[model samples]
Target: MTSLPARLYRALALGWLASKAVVLLVNAVTFPRLHPSRPSLRPRVSLLVPARNEARALPHTLPGLLAQGADEVIVLDDESTDGTGIVAGCLGAQVIRGEPRPDGWYGKPWACQQLWRAASGDVLVFVDADVIWQPGALDAVLHGLEHTGADLLSVQPRQRPVTVGERLLTPLVDNAVLSYFPYPLIGLPQPAASMANGQVMALRRRALEEAGGFAAVRQVVLDDTEFARHLKARGRRLAVALGGPLIGVRMYASYPQSVAGYAKNVLPLHLGSRPLLLLSAVAHLAVYTLPWLVRVPGWRVLRVAGLLERVAANVISGRTRPADLLEGLLGPLTPLLALPVYARALRRTVSWKGRTYPQKAR
Candidate 1:
């Protein structure tokens, strides 16, 4: 017989699994479908890309951005030693030199501020240099913005995890995003509930200005989420959508790279609260990893949890594989893999592109 404490634990785990299942089911049913309708007001759009040593990836990605049919495309070179600026200009982008790194400001934000100054468009679309846009992406984004009447719309581009490490980490990263903001609840009048992906974002010029533009979030590590929060606080409407067939970004080429990328933002996410970080890590481990370790009364609960997590991953990632869901069986290992990244995030002051910023400084 299971002890009272064990029984309670089982109940909690089962409850968590059920909640995940419900969220997955709801997302599957409610994720917005793309019905292409061009905006009546086709605001002139400026496409802004921040490039730093992205020469290898830019050639593959810049052409796609150029083909998106925007009014103007600008690539801001952030002191890249690589030929990012030259390659971008060759691909028909108007390249601009980013200002020198200023204290108390993140690199990407600085590049964005420069792009804003150089741009002359009513709508501004910020895309990372690594993002590959599919045809009709710009059209779809404008359509979504007009349809929702939102000041800002951020599309969680489909992630292509080509490596073993990426496949393992992708689901966890995607799950964290999905768990934070449910798709259906976006546009609700709650300031604390908005979410965004920095991979691709579209914003009305006036709304960007009203939210104090990129300057408002200059010091933020997770500038995308912070920008959304700023818009929400200003009572500007915000929307998030999956960029199905419209965009994709390969975030990291290898496991170590992926871990480093995550470390940059994980600590900053908790807003420097060590206790909150610990609590969140524990809760994530419980919901995402503990099921496989505990011996529940039946395989039914385990199977259900596995299936639900897969469904959630598929919906969030916009890719379906029987193998993908089966992969949830390996979810117990996620915490172990993420632990080192979390530790590094907590202990180290990360230096990116020759500048050092302590994790605790914020």
Candidate 2:
């Protein structure tokens, strides 16, 4: 009636906040800058970008990449209907026209696999086409790799939201991983505790080949997360740090684009288990939405706690748009909104870049 026991929200809320604190701490320490002075002997770096109709995005990202310390840059145009291949070539990148997607392989993994095979550098940097690297980003990436001794490192890009849909859903980007999983655990060589953002991932050539590369996760929709797990299984060290300041990606341009993307990936994030899906849906909705029911006693406390969590998460994520923060904190229907998206995602066959994968892609 009035309120679910404070026991309910307090338990999940405290756990959520505590993990956020850990995420912030780890990110603050681990996010390296382009070493004030460059290293004496940095490994030859190869920048690999997987493009699918990325003509619009390549202009923003490719120029920054070309200026990096990497010895070579390659772009795999994954059967783009647009001028992705032409654009990539004109930008001075060695453009590799992507082959048709093989059966049982996802588009991104296939393209990345192709790029990895052709790469000439000791270190392979896989950047999403949408990502725009700030100056010194490549140096910072190398710094992170050298300092951590990590075989695989993923830099979660800072989100730049131009649309309302992005502002609301992008929290799930960090919140999804950072809230449930601790960064320390993710850093360990444990298959069960692993995370990575495919947008800006780096892998040592030897380790990547040794671990079977994208071929290991050819069928996974959550390609990056699964890639990190595969590397962990091979006993390779894993490291993930903040890349918001180092790079930015506007993940979704419009509401439909945002919804469609999430629909394909979000539900399966729980491993296609309906019960876990339902449970998460209920819990998330209750925490943010139910507390807004002011008729309930002590409701303001619950509301405040939920808002604070969002604010802190936004701050840590480096999304400082006051309007976005205010809208995110005050708009408590995210989970309720998310429920239909996930449900629709579950029901529909997932399609991207003119190819379709099964609803629960293996």
- TM-score on alpha carbons, each prediction: 0.91, 0.90
Name every residue pair that clashes in candidate 1.
none
lDDT of each: 0.77, 0.77
Q: Write the per-residue lDDT of candidate 1 for residues 330-358, one digit (tens) a residue.
A: 66677777877777777658656566666
What does candidate 2's lDDT look like per residue over 177-201, in tens digits?
Answer: 5445656676555697888888888
Q: What's model 1's overall lDDT? A: 0.77
Worst 10 residues of 2 by lDDT: 31-40
Among the numbered candidates, top TM-score falls to: 1
How many clashes in each structure?
Answer: 0, 0
Model 2, residue 204: C-alpha shift (Å): 0.4
